[model samples]
Target: MTGPARSHTEAVAAVGRALAAYETQAGVAADAALVAARRIATDAAAAQADRQRHLERAEADLRACRAEPEARCTAEQARVVQEQHGLEVARRAVSMAERAVRDLAASRVRFRSEAAALITPGRTMTSVKGAELEAYLSSVGLRAVASAGPGSSSAGPVSAQRPSGGGGRDIGGLPEGFELVALDLVDVPDPVTGRDQFGKGYSPEDMAWAFSAFDDVVLPALRAGEGSEYFASLDAAEGRMGTRSYSDTYSGFLGSDAIVLEARPGGRYELSENGRHRFWVAQQTGRPTVPALVRR
Candidate 1:
C-alpha cells in the first residue's frame, strides 16, 4: 500500500511543473508582440508629420513666385497712368493755341471789311464853296452863319472867328482865342489840290473814301455807345492802335476828342489831321460846334 501511493504523488507533481513552465513561455511571447506593435505605430505617425511639412513648404514657395509678378503689374499700371495725364495736358494746350490763332484771323478779316466800306465816292466832298458850306452847316444843325472876315471867299485867305459867349478851352496845342466851331464852317483842304497841313499822304479820292467809311460804319457804332467797345475789339484783333499813323488819326477823330484847325490864307480854315475824323462825324450826324482848337 505505501509504494503505490508514493508513485502516484510523484507523477502528479511532475505534471504540475510542466504546465507552469508552458504558461510562463506564452506570457513572454505576448509581451514581445505588444512592443513590436507600438514601434510600428510610432514610425507611421512620424512619416505622416514629415509629409505635412513638405506640403506646407511647397505652398509657401508658390505664393512667393506669384507675389513678384503682382508687384511688377502694379508698378507698370502706375507708370501708364502718369503718362496718360501728361498727354492730356499737352492736348489741352494745343487746343488753346489753335483757338487763339482762329480768333486773330477772324478779327483781321472784320477790320479789312470795315476799312473797305469807309470811303465811298458818292458821299465825299472835294471842296468848300458857296452854299456847300452853308448847306453843311445846316446839315450839322448850326444856326450861326460864318462871319466874313478879311479873306471870306475860298480864293483868299480864310480866317475863323470865335463866336461871342461861346466859351472854349485851348485844345490840341492850338491858340487860346480859338473857339469851338460847327463842322461846316471849317473847310477841308484837298490833299491833291491844296496844301496838306497835316502831312497826310492821301489823295482826294482817299479822303473821300475815308469819310464815307467813317460816316457809314463808325458813326453808327459811336451813337450806339459802342465806341469804346469797338476800339477795344479792333485793338485786340489788330494788336494795338497808333501802330499805323493814319489809323491813329482815324481812331482819334472817332474818339470825339478836341479837333484842331488853322486859319488858311482864304476865309476857309484847314482841317487838321487829328480833327478830320471828328469833323467828318459831326458833319454826317448833324452835330453842331465840334470842339476845335484853332491856330492863326
Candidate 2:
C-alpha cells in the first residue's frame, strides 16, 4: 500500500480499537451502576427499618416522660423532643435513600441502552464529538471517563484563582480519587448572619417552618396537580432558607456542569463554591467518583 493509504488504514484501525475500549469501559460502568443501585436499595430498606424502630422508641420515651409529674418531666420532655427531631431527620434520610435507589436503577437501564446504541454497527460515529460521551455518561449517573488522547474531549481542570472570602480548607473522608466534593466546603461570608457559611444550617425552628410550609402549601398544591405554582412556591421557600432547591440539585447532578475541585498538599480535595447539594447527594449515594474540574 502507498504511504498515505497505509496511514489512513492505520488511523481507521486506531479508531476501531478506541471504540472497542470505550464499549468495554461503558459496559463495566453499566454493570457497576446496576450493582450500586441494588446495594443502595438494600441499604435504604435497612435504613427505613432502623428509622421506624427509632421513631417507635422515641414515641415510647415521650409517652413515658409525659406520664411523669410536670415539674420532674421538663428535662425528660426536652430530651424526648430532641429524639423526635432526630427521628424526623432519619426519616428524611430514608426518603432520600429510597429516591436514590430508584434514580440509580433507572440510570443503570438508560446507561446500558445508550452504550449499546453507541457501539452498534453503523451507529458508532454519529455526532461523536466534543464532550458528547462525557455528557452521556453524566446523564446516566456514571463518572465521566478520562480522555484517552488529544482529540477526545474530557472534564479538564479549572482555573487557578481561589474563590473569595471563605474559610478555604481541604475536607477529609472522601474516597481516594473522588472527583466531586461538597459545596459546603466553601465557606462564604454570610451577609445576613455575618459569619462564614457554606450551606444553610437549619435550626429546629427552621425545620419546623419548612415542614409546615411543605405540608400546608407545597403538598396540597402538588396533590392538586398544580405544577408551576407548586414549584414556584418551593423555590421561594428554598430561596428564603438560602439553600439550593432539592429539585434543582437533582437536575444539576444529571446535567453536565463541571465540578470544580482544589487539590490540597496531602492529596485531599476541596470542593469549590459552585458545588452544592450534588456533592452531598454523591456522598449519600456512596458514589466512588464523579466528574470534576480540578484546579491546577
Candidate 3:
C-alpha cells in the first residue's frame, strides 16, 4: 500500500500520466520506423542502379572481346555472365527492401488503431465518471473508493450502462457522422447514490432548470467546436456556479459540468456519465436539439 485514501482522480491521473508518456514514445518509434524503411528503399534502388551500370559495361566489354582474337573472347564472355548474376542479386535486394517498407507501414497502422482505443479520450471505453470510471480503474488493476466525506467505502460495482437502446457494441452505428436528436430523447442514469441532485432539498424540476441555465451558459463555445474556449467557458461557469449563492440553489453542483452526450452504435441521445441534471431539464423544458460530442 503506497498509502490509503488516495483520491479517485489522483489514481486515474497516474495512469493518464503513464499513457501520455507512452503516446509520445509510440509516436517517435513510428516515425523512426518509417524513416528507416524509406532509407532502406532508397539505398536498395541506388544499389540496383549501380549494378545495372556494371552489367551494361560488361556487355560492352564482351562485344569488344568478340571483335578481338577468339582466345580472349571466352574470358570476356565469362566475366559478362558474372556481371549479369550480380545485377539479378541487386534486383532481389531491392524487392526485399520494398517488401519491408510495406510490412512496417501496415504494422504502424495497426499500432495506431489499438493505441487509439487506449489513449484517445473519446475512443476510450470508459468516461471518467460513474460506473464506467470505476470499471476502468479495476480493469487496470486499481480499485478506488469514492471519497464520500468521512465514512468512505469502496465505490462498489454499479450496473453496466449503455446509451440509446443497448445491444453489444456495433462500431458501424454512425458510419457517416453525428446525429442530432431532441433533448427529450435523452435518458439520464438511474441514481447511483439512490437519487441524483433531485434529492438534495430542491425539487427535481427546479434543479433541472438550474442545470439547463448552466448549460445554456456553457453551450455556445461548445457548439462552435472550440475545445479550449469551451473548456475555459466551462470552468468559468463552474466557478460562478460553485459560489455560495449558486451552490446553495443548485444542489452544491460545481466544476466540469459540460453536458457530454454519447451516441454509441445506436442512434440515440442520452446524458453522458455526469450529465444528470441537464437531461432532466431537457425532458422537462422541451429544449430543442443541442450539439453533442458523439463519441462511440
Candidate 4:
C-alpha cells in the first residue's frame, strides 16, 4: 500500500509542472498582443491628426477663392471710372476750340463795317436834273462823266450832236496811261431832262458842293502824295461869242518835242504846253524856246 501511494504523488507532481509551463506560454502571448494593440492605436492617432491639418488648409483656400471675384470687380470699376474722366476732358477741349473760332469771326466783321462809314460823305438831293446839271457844270470848264457804250469804239468820236453849236461835238482829253471807263447805267441821269432819277437839278452850287466833298471826304482817304485825274467840260453861253470862241493854247500846231508860244489875252505872249508846264514866257522871238525852259 505504501508503494501505490508514492507513485500517485509523483504523477500528481508531473501534472502540476505541465500546467505551469502552459501558463507561462499563455502570459507571453498576452504581453505580445498588448504591444501590438498600442502600436495600432498610435498609428490611428497620427492618421487622424494629418487629416485635420489637410482640412484646415482646404478651408483657408476656399475663403480666398470666395474673395477673388470681388477684387476683380473693384479693379474693373476703377478702370471704367478712369475712362469716363478721359472722355470728359476731351469734350471740354472741343467746346473751348469752337468758342475761339466764333470770337475771331466776330472781330473781323466789326473792323470792316467801321472803315466804310468813315470814308463816304452823307448828302441828300431833291429835284436834281441830269442834263441841266451837266450844262451848268460844263459852263465852268467842267465835263460830266461820260459813258462808253459796249460796241462803241474807244478812240471814236466822243460827242453828241445837238441841232446847232457846231453839232456839239466834244473831244476826249485823257492823260497818258489812263483809259475812259463808263459808270453804271443806274447812276447816270436822263439825257432829255436835266434831272437824275430823284428829280433833282444840278446847279453851280451842286458842282461846288461836289468839289468840296471830294476835297474833304475823298482826298484825305487817299494815300499820301498820290495824284488823281479830273476831267471838265465847259460851255459857252449865248451873246458871249467873243469869249465863247475858245482857243486852246496849242491850237496852232504842236510837235512831239518842240516848245511853243502861248499868247495871253491880257496883252502878254507867254510860252506853255496848253496850261501844262507854264512857268517860262519869252518876248516874241523865234529862238528855239524849249532849251530856255529846261528847269535848270
Count of backbone clashes, every candidate in sequence: 12, 0, 0, 18
After superposing all C-alphas onto the true structure, candidate 2 shows an RMSD in angstroms of 23.8
* Cα lDDT of model 3 by residue, 146-264, tens digit: 53211012211111223234321222111223333455556556723323445554465655555443332222212223334433333343454332223332223333443556754
List runs of model 2 lying over 4 Å from the truth.
1-11, 66-71, 122-296
TM-scores, one per candidate? 0.31, 0.34, 0.43, 0.22
lDDT of each: 0.43, 0.44, 0.49, 0.30
RMSD of each: 51.4, 23.8, 17.6, 58.5
- For candidate 1, give the lDDT: 0.43
> How well is each residue in 179-238 modelled by candidate 4, as lDDT tens digits?
111111011112223223222333333333333432222222221121221101111111
Better of 1 and 3 by lDDT: 3
Instruction: Give the C-alpha miss distance for residue 201 in model 3, angstroms.
Output: 43
Can you write out model 2's per-residue Cα lDDT over 175-200, one digit (the tens) per residue? 23333333444322222231233346
Better-scoring candidate (lDDT), 1 or 4: 1
- Lowest summed lDDT across 10 adjacent residues in model 2 is found at 155-164
Candidate 2 pairs with clashing backbones: none
* Best candidate (score: TM-score): 3
Compared with the true structure, what per-residue lDDT tens digits does model 1 show for residues 71-98?
4454444544555555555455555545
Rank candidates, lDDT, best first.
Answer: 3, 2, 1, 4
- Give the distance in Å from residue 117's predicted Cα in candidate 3 to where it truly belongs: 2.0
